[model samples]
Target: MAASGKKNNILKVLLIIVLIIGLVAAWLGYQAFMSPSIATSEDYFYVHTDEPYESVIKRIEDEGIVKNPTYFKYVAKSMDLQNGIKPGRYKLSKDLSNRRFIGNLRGGYQEAVPFRFQNLRLKENFAGALGKSFEADSTTFLNILNNETIAEKYGFNKDNFFSMFIPNTYEIYWNTKPEEIIDRFASEYKKFWNADRKAKAAALDMTPEQVSVLASIVKGEALHVDEMPEIAGLYINRLKRGMLLQADPTVIFANNDFTIRRVLNRHLTIDNPYNTYRYKGLPPGPIMMPSIASIDAVLNYNHHDYIYMCAKDDFSGYHNFAKTVAEHQINARKFQQALDARNIKK
Candidate 1:
């Protein structure tokens, strides 16, 4: 009878030990699968296209994004994440749990990348910047930008293609194709030429394209926002009188050299249509990417009789405007002297 009692007691103790083990296992499973697995380290993780599973897991471990890579792997495998990997830019947060984090990636949930276009001096530079910002490479982007056939679809040429891109920020997926980017910007350009802006352009007796052309020159000439209107007014005066634009910026564009600090007589004689001195109207396209401010300044140009402008000799990033050639020559001479004193021969 005592032997039977001893056996019963031993069995009861064994059952209790089994129950404790099961509870511990359950807790660990919950922690691994349901609790947060990401650390408070980074706010983003980009799972590049065509990346293999092991590389991604290793990268997650290397970046300390996961609290425990082993546990993460276990949870991922259990959740069928091995067959569900999707490439994209994923948002990371410490509050993200293992299940939520893995599920978000598996479902292809991604953050939109902010792409900004501004102050790009050339299309090649713009393409390079876009390549770094998006999935499209610069060669592909440049090909699309320069393709005469494709450019015609957007009403653009190799030189005026940049006008389609309004300088602003766009939130788009990182893997957006080059064609889609072009289409989106074309849509934006079309949308920007609304009835009101179109009427303003018509009031100036100009096409939207012509406004962009003049705005680019105004932007090139003016360093301060306040000077843009006056500079634009001076150009408008010249245009009204059928005078040669004679814009130095256009000459620089014609020379294909932006480093010319002083426009010499030789530079003015460039035979290209873009050379405003040689041409009687606005350049065939914009000389540079005009900003919205510059465009608005042209649309709402200040009414004035000034037909000429020269950079201020005071070096205050302002310009001196005059209605007569004599006054403009004086201002030009002063600015030229300043440039010569500083040895800016180019």
Candidate 2:
């Protein structure tokens, strides 16, 4: 009886030990999988193209995104996240668990970054801005824009391809392919030119690209929103009469010198198609990205016989419109006098 009793006690002790061990293991598993791992400092974690999984782990550690790297690594390994890593911008929430973070990465739940640009003067400027906003470099986008084949594929050439990008805020993924971005812009362009807009363009005897070119010119000339329609009307009148646009903004663009406050006779003689004073009608392409307001103004232009506009002498960013050369010369002289008075010699 004594031997049997001792054996029973020994069994009870062993049972207690096993229970303690199981509880400890459960606690450790909870700590690794259920504990909050993410920190609130970073809003996003970026994984670059072809980046090593080990590098991602190190980045998480180095960026202080996770409180415990070991726990994250263990969870990631268990879920096979390394094999399913995707390159993108992932959103990081405060107090996220290791399992949830790893699952998000594995599932490729990326955040869409807002890409916004406007009033850019050149394609190079746009490319540089776009490069800073996304993973694709400036050279990649610029090359695609400059490629004759790609431009032609989109019904444009290198010279006029800049007009295809309608300036606005758009949501896109960080790791979006350069070609995919162009396709998105093309889709947006089609949506913008609906049947009503197309009919208006046809009535004005201009294509969508031509309207954009004029809209850019109008945007460059007009500072006030209300004046845009009048400016558009004036340009349309010039185009209809077969007269040179003789726009000073085009002169500034052709000279590649935006610092010229005043356009002179010397600047007008530039040997470039963009020089509207020397060439006829619109430029080969838009000098700047046209705004939606400017574009709509062109589509709804105010009809008038006034063909000339000179900046008002008051420097209120308003222009004096005239119907004839004699009246336009008077307005120009007043503006010149005002510039001289202000010592704005270019």
Q: Please, what is the whole-model Cα lDDT of each candidate in the order they appear?
A: 0.87, 0.91
Model 2 — which ten-residue stretch has the worst lDDT? 35-44
lDDT of 1 by residue, 138-244 (tens): 99998888788887887777767777888989898887778988898899899888998999999999988889889999999888888888889989999999999
Per-residue lDDT of candidate 2, residues 56-94 (tens digit): 989888888888788888888999997998899988877
- Pairs of colliding residues, candidate 1: none
By TM-score, who's the top model here? 2
Specify the poorest-scoring 10-residue window by lDDT in model 1: 154-163
Q: List residue ranges in candidate 1 displaced over 4 A.
A: 1-4, 39-42, 61-64
Clashing pairs for model 2 are none
